[model samples]
Target: MSDDANRHDPAPNLVLGDADGGRLAENIMHFARVLRTAGLPVGPGKVLDAIDAVSQVGVASRRDFYWTLHAVFVNRRDQREVFDQAFHFFWRNPNLLERMMGMLLPAMRGEEAPEDKPELSPRVAEALAGEREPERPQEQEEEEIELDAALSVTDREVLAEKDFEKMTKDELDRARQAIKRMRLPIKPVKTRRYRADPGGRRADLRATLRASARQGGDLIWLKKRSRRRENPPLVVLCDISGSMDRYARMLLHFLHALTNDRDRVHSFLFGTRLTNITRHLRDRDPDAAIDKVTAAVEDWAGGTRIGESLHRFNADWSRRVLSQGPVVLLITDGLDREGAAGLEVEMERLHKSCRRLIWLNPLLRYDGYAPKTAGARAMIPHVDEFRPVHNLDSLAKLADTLSRSESAATGEMVRWKKLAA
Candidate 1:
């Protein structure tokens, strides 16, 4: 429970139906259930709180009533989208329901729906379809295929290609489990610091002198040494703005896995500001770690200020964490609230400070995507690699791609340079 939950009767309550208090409370309780099913953290306590709050506000208007329930149920910013959709569907409005139906029914009818109607999130869609809980999709058994691939198309394969935003509740759970088993292949870089080696090119003159003094003998054996090779420090800068909410949780799982798997990985989450969540991510349990991160970060699913966030990172964190030339993974869609003000300079500075700068943009999943945004254009030219980070396949490919001991592709750089131009 958050501090807000422990407050002295802070105003927020559940209210449903316009008839009577008893019926309104009952319907509101059921609505809370819907929200819980739709991936909200709503519980019995919140329903009670909402009920208590409703008496104070009264059934003034639909807007007031809606807000009263929302305050109690929706604690986190990311949950707002899901809760909003669920509320509209669960309460069952005529015009909105018809629009939702138009958007939902077209696929079954074998035709595309009109673009005018908004589509529902998979979580919201599944929550509303609780006519009966459909059998959870089971993993398909591998079947022999003649196509020269080792594995045929299976649920795992489908999941590998599917966008993180479109996954249902069951699929999301399966995906998280799969991500837990993933390993990011480590790529070590040779540092200037030296360590003792049995057979090496460089002589350890200082060690030999110290050894000779201790032994007090002419028969002094010279020691050999070599530069230490270690996995480069990995620094992740992940965006947590509203535009990125769908991908944020999934990516946090990946970050958590990486942090637990290795050392020297620093993670910072940014939306309107930068937050260092490296310590929180060190927790072994993913859920607990994310909870800690949520508590630490104040700007989750809020407005993006990429330029301002980057500037802050460059000013405050660059020296402390960027030492030893870390490989920086800047994860964002490059949406900036400041419209790219001061972005180019900071990006260039960050690029210079790091050994490699890889920008993982979920927007790259779209085939015809362009750096049309001011922030995207300003930052693109500075990145060593502009890659997609939307699905399991892309993450796996990122692991494989980073593992290779090769320089950045010339054509890739040229293409992005042209795009930025």
Candidate 2:
């Protein structure tokens, strides 16, 4: 008999037999199911890891088992609290699920809790039950809440509430699922090329002679084929400074999707300096691709040196990437702490090299945004377009902007150029 069998309690009808072992396994399966419902990816592999963890630590001690499973499953800071609450509630006792069901019933009935409710859990239960709900003073406030709630409400609402910067380990896993399913529409730009002319103004002498030879020296008309221009290359330079970290990460995910679906899309990341992440992002898996990019980029979340980085890019990579009139995407907040002199020169070089330069600034999400910063002033004049990139709506607008030929003519861009002169 195992050590746990000898110490098994008889008062609560506890026994350590094959049946009890099966029950434990069943509870574990239920635990994994609850975790999955809570937006954690508790797949069979993670379940197996949980089982191994339980065996290694022994399930005789409830606290030890709780922490063991936690170590195996919970990853992010935000997820830890949820997982902890779920774990406690899930494994409370034989009547735990019944208690949770009872708590949920009050929530379903929309009954308000008494003002003098005791304990934090019951208060949480009351709040969850829609008791004393905060009133929105304006229709706009309610609309915004409704919009947020409407986003993937049936799928994973908890994960959606998590900010990209504040995601926990398990929440990050759930976030990846949403990110992987995100569709990025990257349109192709056609470029000029040569082909055999089908109906040229001048006759094709070689083809005419070959056709005559085939027809025993008799004159025979021949048709000619022609080649046409193809799309311009897509070059992306994403900023990874402290201000742009979240936007950059999300954009990288979009770029990864684009790179897989499109051709000739080059991606680079810059914070303190330029790092070519085109090859790294080519990986089939987004997580693996991001891992490779993180490994390659040494200046993540560092101070912004846009001018210096652009200078380096213009000096080393411009000729290679800017050839054939590639369309350039400059994703940054234009909060260059590196001053404006070097940035002005580099921005000018970048503008001259590319067919068109589109600036994507997350700060543009604000209604009253202006190019008042030194960096924004220096770079705005050189860019062909300036666009916002913060939320889903903006990202959708970005796809439309990239597809259309309409140029960016913001008052800020025009005013900045005059001020610089």
Candidate 3:
């Protein structure tokens, strides 16, 4: 290799502690912390690795630095956008330091800054904002304690109805906490298996004879058996496409709670492909579970291919998860990229396979919502229940609905279809 080629080729591993290496390493550490705050799952070990990688490469060029950190920090495709945004704001922008300095001054509190910052996602915004704990006077603290207790109740009521898209970072945290406390109060479905019941309607002749034998043929006692009742499995097919991203994360928290509360709960996430994350959600810690899911899923925040995804589910997963008349919760907006091709067939099959098929669309939160899309129209006819899954109130309603013995009627579907037409 020529001398010019050697300069461009670069060394295999970055050497540490160059002239400006210490300052660069500090910036890298801070940047890693920022990413961790924004929900990227960046750890201290990753931070050190990133520093070392950058040290070897030398951040003489901006592109080289960006790619170096991106390779080290971004683990999932969904995190790419967030990482890019944070990178530009943290390093590339010359005015970010000026803005930070401006924010610290007491006089700048009411004054509008000359430059406006780009809006970040709720998670990112929350991480970058960081936590603040200020000292309070004893008298003021007591007043706040009394006020906070009353405010918490009122706040919960308000949060129940608040839309996921409209919620602030603090509100989102409260919503997650609320969802974690939620439980599904579903009625058990009777199975083919029989269990001995003293007052059962069906008499078991063999058991009756055995009872008589026990009594030495002197007396007879009728023995009865009843169908065993157990909580049916729950299968959730959630859409994690770009459009459903905000609602999906909240719903995952809800799913984690449900998984811990019940038995035989299966979860599959789909964007352009289907991924079974049932094992991932079984983690005891919500953060750890979500992190596992983020690392395991490949097509997160991608485009929607609803028809294809459903077709894949029906063909591959229906037999395994849809046994014993399990209740299916289909969560998506029903916007198919292929114009609802083959959706009707797959939906009909899914409806027949499961005892109850519930379509939970966040769009239904709107008062005048209708099944306007082709995908929505095809799916509306097959679902036993059509409900909104946007807020805590909606989820509570869903839990109540499932607990009831009676499922939703076909009339509701007719009304929706007519409205769509």
The reply for model 1, stretches above 4 Å from the true place, is 1-25, 51-61, 93-116, 131-153, 205-223
Candidate 1: pairs in clash: 13-50, 14-50, 14-51
Question: Residue 167's C-alpha lDDT in candidate 1?
Answer: 95
User: 81-150 in candidate 1: lDDT tens per residue?
Assistant: 7877676555544243344455567555333343333567899877666533367767769864566543
Taking the tens digit of each residue's C-alpha lDDT, what string does model 2 give over 1-421?
Answer: 1122233333222222254476666667667776766656579888888877776777666556657787888764335545665655555456554455554565532223223323223222332233223667765544443445443565465555444544544455556556666654544455454456777554567777888898898668775644555566889999998778767877788889778877788998998889999999899988899889988988887789899889889989988888888889999998887675589888998999988888988887667877888898888778888888765456556667766663445655576467545
CA-lDDT, candidates in order: 0.82, 0.69, 0.80
Model 3 spans > 4 angstroms off: 1-32, 43-72, 84-120, 131-151, 166-174, 285-288, 407-411
Residue 63 Cα positional deviation in candidate 1, in Å, after optimal superposition: 3.6
Root mean square deviation (Cα) for candidate 3? 6.9
Supply every candidate's count of residue pairs whose N, Cα or C atoms clash at under 3 angstroms.
3, 21, 1
What's the true lDDT of residue 71 in model 1? 90
Off by over 4 Å in 2: 1-192, 196-217, 220-227, 406-421
Question: TM-scores of all models?
Answer: 0.82, 0.58, 0.77
lDDT of 3 at 218: 93
Best of the candidates, TM-score: 1
Comparing 2 and 3 on TM-score, the stronger one:
3
lDDT of 3 by residue, 1-421 (tens): 1111123323222222346555567667777877887767799899989978877886665667678888899876667767876665455343444443344455764443324545445555454456222447566444443334644777779989989987866788888988999999889989998999998999988999998999999999989999999999999999999889889999999999999999999999998999999999999999999989988988887888888998999999999999778999999999888898998999999999998998999999889887989999889888888899999999999988898765345667678767766
